[model samples]
Target: AKWREPKLDGRITEDLTINELEQYWNPLLFIDNILSETKETQWLMAQRNETGEVYLLERRRIKGVFLETLELNDFPLDVQDLTITVTSERPESEVDIIPDQNEMSAINVQTFVDQQEWKLHEHVEITKRIMKQEYSSSMKSHACLSVTCRAARRPGYFYWNVFLIMFMISSLSFATFAVSPDKAELRLRLSFTLILTSVTFKYVITQSLPKISYLTYMDKYVLMSLAILCIISVWHAIVTLLDPEHIATKYSKPANLFDLYGLQQHKSFLPPDTAVKSTNNTQNETDNFFKEHASLDNGFADNLLAFFLGSEQMEEADQSAESKTSTDNGNLSTSVGDQQNTTVPRLSNECSLDNKMACEEWKRVQIVEQHVFTSFVIIYVIAHAVFIFWLYFDASRRRREMRQKDKDYRDFLRRHQQWQQQSLRQRDMHAILRSSLHT
Candidate 1:
């Protein structure tokens, strides 16, 4: 409840006791939106201004929890309004509520202890409104005043801990490509691991925020990263299923280029006496051909080809091939030797064809992977940029609306003051006319 007293003489401002304040009329005012009250204290003070106008002030200090609605679409970058509403029990005809023109509402930010998480603004907003209550078809209007303060959530914590971590984990999914595409199990395992990590991190982040149905900015980012991870895993599966080398390794053992070339070029390293011994061991050689090529799997085949084809190793391999060819000509005596020579060339040609096809397929998949990664990066950047621009423009629009409201309120106060002065002058003139008529 609020009460005030007026006196004719100027006096020093002093606090009045509650018993003394009961002698004056009081407006029954209460906070309408408070959830719970911890403590409240109130006092009255009287003072006179320079113009000899006496005024009474009711000072109140209240500490309690209040109810408020928060919109979290922007989430980590969102601003919230904290409001306190005071409503009078008496109708508008018996009580009036208005902002004090001589005093401006303000907030003391120096005392705020949660500065690390939220930034509190010093400017306070006061609004006067009339609310109508209906009781059995009868209506009464009550005066209400609301004071609001704005606070913006600090995004730095979420940026580093949540968003940055999510981005890094999502990017690691791309590194799965470093593993051979034929090793689909390894690549898929890595991709799924990153995806699960992102999902768990999202849950941890969500625990810090209120449960809401709509997606926030941070939620959108996490979902985007998750989608990218899913795409990466799917691509890995697709490439593995479509790859010729992977299929060959899965169904039947294929002769790899490494075993075929290595055996042909190093055959000359055997001693002259072992040459006939080696030729006689044709059956053992046939068994070793399947064993050696079967172990020469497709993992890192392209990388090995790239290293050997572009380095001094290729020159050494060519020299070894020439020496083996000369040694073969010198030992072309037995019919079994001629048949072995023909079989080596035929096996070499088949291995070369299979290797070339697999390499081309891998190269095509690599190009597609590069394009996909670049597209995802571009899309992510553009989406975030658009979101930021929308937030910026939305904030600017809200500020403009607030300024317009303040301007309109000022105009209303000015007009109300002029109307009061006009009424006073007319009343005085009517009294003077009545006095003259009585005379």
Candidate 2:
């Protein structure tokens, strides 16, 4: 019922005979309205096969034509029920029936058919797209958009920009290694700036995408990278601004009741396992090493003793300390516990008189500490550098990496510069401290 061919009718008397019927039937031909809209068109519509999906009633576009409109075919119709009405039929006279002899077919019938054909084609197109179901699926997924646009210049420039940003960031992060561990301000300044940079990046990137509840991989990657860089900056800030020795004391040192008693006697104990002392194999030497050095009856007074015992240099030094103690007096060792308990007090007059001596002793300790610190710092830098290089190389250089590297590098450079400054400042403090021994 969706489509129907326009029907035609004719009436003639039987007495008018076979010749007239032959003449009427001779001119009968279906109009091919779909393709030929001309009223005087030459082509005729004839069913190729009733069972076919479409028919080439005329030699034009009906075959293999991509129908943009809804395709219509194979609908049942009342072709058999068509009835002819006789206006008049008589034996004395012949009756002839026909409409506007110049045009015996429906008028403007093709126009109506064209509108229906377009609607059918449009419906078909819509239904097929809905069934295919491709583009609309984007509503719920976080899949990476695989862009297939043919814009060469646009994508080219975009790729270049991404590369450049990443290059800069990576350079920035890499610069952290060059920062010294001493300066506190450098890390602080750099960290604040990089955090702002990351915020700006987030804002910029978001402008190009729709707001989504679930994060795309790109979003997660950006966020994670920002977090990592923030942490890196924090670490640098801590190392640069804070005094490791002071912090270690605050956090790692166990509290003890006896600390109030000046049990350590103003001695700032270095970290454990950092030095070596000698084992006194002989009874005389063993008695001096523990008995002379230990303040409490407990073995802790000679904790440094246990550390340095493995080295020959420290053993020689121990011998010197013993000789020095022996010079104080033979009776200094008379009561081992009493001698160890007594803290050496600097004399008021000796403050000026022994200025050179105190400075010399401090200089010696500083040199030893410097040697230890420099050796360990070198080892730490080598190990850490290897790790960072591997991480950078192993990871993909997405736009995200570039941004990360930029922020991280800024912090890295700041920390490096700060640490260098801290080292210089430490040296200055040490010099000033030693010089005060004279004043």
Candidate 3:
């Protein structure tokens, strides 16, 4: 509100109470989007310049919560705008709310309570627009002014507690490969455990966010980790089903010829009483042969067999062989030679076949597991890199937009100042012409 007070020059009145100010003009201002008004204080002041023109300025300080819609596609990495919109009860034709060109809106960042979770920007944006009345059938619009402040969520907390934990859990699936391929039960158990852990972690993370229909970036990452764990579990089952030793046992028939030769060879090297005892245990030994060899750990079985057959027996057998008559020794030698000639070649051929099959199986399992691990690593790296780049570009775009807005605002202020100066000059010219005519 403006008025002319010829009696006053470069003077200002004290702050007027609400009642006193209501005696004059009022715009009937109120917050449009406020949820609740906590406290409000308003006062008016009158100031007169050297030209005897008085200006009435109304100042209001309000504290309250305002409603804002959030976009959570980026979630923990997103920036949000908090706005306070003010609108007048009077229509736009009667009351127009405009920003003060001389005073730019601002926010005090030091007063923000969520400093650890959000970085509040100091600059405030003021937008003035006409809002159409929804209830009115006529084309009625209200003057609305919105003051907005931006705040960026700090992602470090989520990165450490959620993303890092999920990555570690998914990585545990790769460690399951260290278990032998034949132990599919153990590998699968570990993989499933990782999957469950990931799911539970995701649930905990979701509880901290709003219930939205679409997935957030963090949700996508967790899902990818779970998928990788499931793939690992399936691979474990595949490798176990294709186990070489199990296949060989299933297809190969028992060769009693090798067992008979093995028993005779042990008896031939033992002393008389020891040979009798060995003969007695021969049936039991032959029964356990298939079971032991089926689960053999490559060459470790040979060392285990020698360790079980005591060294004392070997020394006694050596003494008995030295004492034996030449005729008996020659007959024993011929018998052993006959057994070797008949059975050794066949046994060697069968053993070689089993070894070749085992070697091929090992190579196939290694190739597949290596490929899976490498592929998962590559995909994980690429996914994180893409997310990082997206965040960087998004922040850059917002910064550019803010800079452009500031530039435009400055230009508007310059033009407004020029127009005001021109109007004042025209008024002075009119006043001079009037004085000249009166003279």
Residues 1-439 of candidate 1: C-alpha lDDT, one tens digit per residue: 3233564245444555556655666687788889999999987656566556656666789999999999787777777888999988888998898887655565677999899998776556888898876652557889999999877777788889887888789778878878865577899999888988888888888888889899987898789889888988998888766554453333221223434446554232221122223433533564454444433432323223322232333454345344444444223223223434544444333333333444455556667767876876777678667756866676445444545655665676677678878977998899899899999
Point out the worst 10-residue segment of candidate 1 by lDDT. 267-276
lDDT of candidate 2 over 254-280, digit per residue (tens): 212114334354334432112011111
Predictions in order: lDDT: 0.64, 0.36, 0.63
- 1-439, model 3: which lDDT tens digit per residue? 2333333335455544546545766678888898888999876767655466766667888888889999777777776888888888888888878877545565666899999988776657878888987977776889899888787778889889988898888877889878866577898888888888888888888888899998777787789788878877888888777664454334322222234334333322221122223433533453354344433332322222222222323454344334443445345444333433343333333333323444455557567778877886787678778767875676445645555665676677677778888988999999999899999
lDDT of 1 at 426: 95
| Candidate number of the best TM-score | 3
**What's the true lDDT of residue 218 in model 3?**
79
Q: State every prediction's TM-score relative to the real structure.
A: 0.65, 0.27, 0.68
- Point out where model 2 deviates above 4 Å: 1-157, 163-167, 240-439
Steric clash pairs (candidate 1): none
How well does candidate 3 score on lDDT at residue 110? 82
